[model samples]
Target: MRRLACAPDTRPLISDRNHLGALAYCYATREEDCLPYRTARDFYARRVAPELPETVLTAILLVSPGRSLTRRGNVAELPRGKQWFDEGLPERLHHFCTDIAPSLCPTPPTVINTDGATPETVLAQVAGVLADAGLDQTAQRLASATAHAPRPPLDPRFVDTYTQLGGLEAFGHPFTPPIAHRGGTVQLCRLGAPHHDPAGHTRLWNPLGPGPWPPPGPAWSR
Candidate 1:
């Protein structure tokens, strides 16, 4: 999306699939996801937070059930064919569609439920939602924000490392908002996930790697 905005004479685009949806689906599955909440948060921090004024999270709750029973395969005329939904997949989808997805947003997103609405109706509602969210003059807002995005706060524990590593340029900014993670304080930057462990050890998750790994420093080498 950002790349598109940079196209000469191109206008800002409306992105349908944002981190919000991906996070919701990832949570719904609850698998050993390699890039779950972390991916979503990074995107929010790097792109959405600075570019957009407001967010719109659409919930197509009806698809949860419909997906499970939908037809598939070549020609795909018969029910319970290819793409047969997994057991509990529907439930999880429904749960995410209705509940968990909305909670993760920094602010409550304006949700539009497209259970049984026509295309015209959905489009109209979305237009209203965009207007209410004050998303007018997208190009202007994006340009301005790029120049002066609100400085997201940093975890004090990470201040020294961030400074040494080259603050905004090398580490980018704090991707995740202030949130408690599993048994530790986690703050993600562009380069890595800096964690202040409850056991009093600091570690980092390599965002570019497959998973968490030791960071470069005298302390971690030990």
Candidate 2:
């Protein structure tokens, strides 16, 4: 369940029976709106794919909100004609199909459209995506979604830690810090199901683990 900010060239394909997921946000018109997206995609293909554990499941969300040049207001104007992509307006269609999809071995990448869905809907889509990827246990996935909001606050600490992992720089930029710093924030939202033993014992599951065993996250302690 590791999240890495990467470019298309470096993005890795999930090559095992593990459940995996990813989110990609692109601005169709303002393709240049966020240089980080392209950078992150490239990073994953080259550096991140090689080191992935064979048992890990992979999932990705590609969000491409069409770009616009209009400003929210004129009072805070910098350049009159300056253009920027609207924060969250356009719907994300299933675009940019990646080779990584077929690479998932037994599990395949599920492409979701963020066009008209709410955050909760999108999260649910992600859960379904992971399930289709062969990471069974959907009931737990629903429970995991309850513990937190659709969007989680970004933790800077996690970004820093991931950066230290070897070959991480492939995801970094020269003048700025790693794209993961920003993209990672969007990915910090924890959503998944709690792992339960056949005996009916509930346990915590951490999605961030590289292993394919039980998913990761805390269980409701009764």
Candidate 3:
């Protein structure tokens, strides 16, 4: 059974409540209700319409010390597929906005890079972007709500909207999209629900566990 995953934001109404509403929506609809890994694989084969919002409705930038980039092996390390995504995906994502999304929206995405900026600076930038996007009220509400947001331990599979606005170092590793799984023959797949094999789960979870991360770097850091 194919599933459609959405990135929340349904209740874009109440100013103070909307940001959390959107997050709850995304968490409930996309992460909890829909299976993104399976859906992405299905998308690869079928070339279906993207389940997430089309266009760079917003561009969330994460800036960190070059050390953070080295630490995370580059933000590109987060996207699924392509061995080179770790090296190339950031540019690719940028291109997607500049080249691909313009056809769909009058306004381009609002980009935020918090490489050396403070939280207040980051928040101001986010507010500016939202204001430019004609979402000032929404941005104001989010600014307040995010300040009080109770952070959960990082889940590498879950994308953090806050991280996109900078402060990734404080949030721990940013959770990214997971690689999709393509099961074997149709007959072999039916023995149980089509899902990731054991190895696939390991690859997906490796970044989150305590250990030496593959490809090697600092042996003493979290």
- Which model scores highest in lDDT? 1
Off by over 4 Å in 2: 1-47, 67-108, 132-222
Per-residue lDDT over 1-222 for candidate 2, one digit per residue giving the tens place of the 0 to 100 score: 222222233443333222233323332223332335456556666766666554444455544443212223423132211222234322322233354344532344445555555667766766565454444464246436753434332345445443333112222212222234323322322223223333433233332335754323322110
lDDT rank order? 1, 2, 3
TM-score of each: 0.39, 0.32, 0.35
Deviation (Å) of 49 in candidate 1: 7.8
Per-prediction backbone clash count: 0, 37, 2
Angstrom error of the Cα, residue 87, model 2: value is 10
Q: Rate the local accuracy (lDDT) of all candidates.
A: 0.48, 0.37, 0.37
Clashes of 1: 0
lDDT of 3: 0.37
Candidate 2 displacement at residue 25 in angstroms: 9.1
Residue-level lDDT of model 1, residues 75-113, one tens digit each, is 323221212244464566667656665554445555555
* CA error at residue 184 for candidate 2, angstroms: 23
Clashing pairs in 1: none
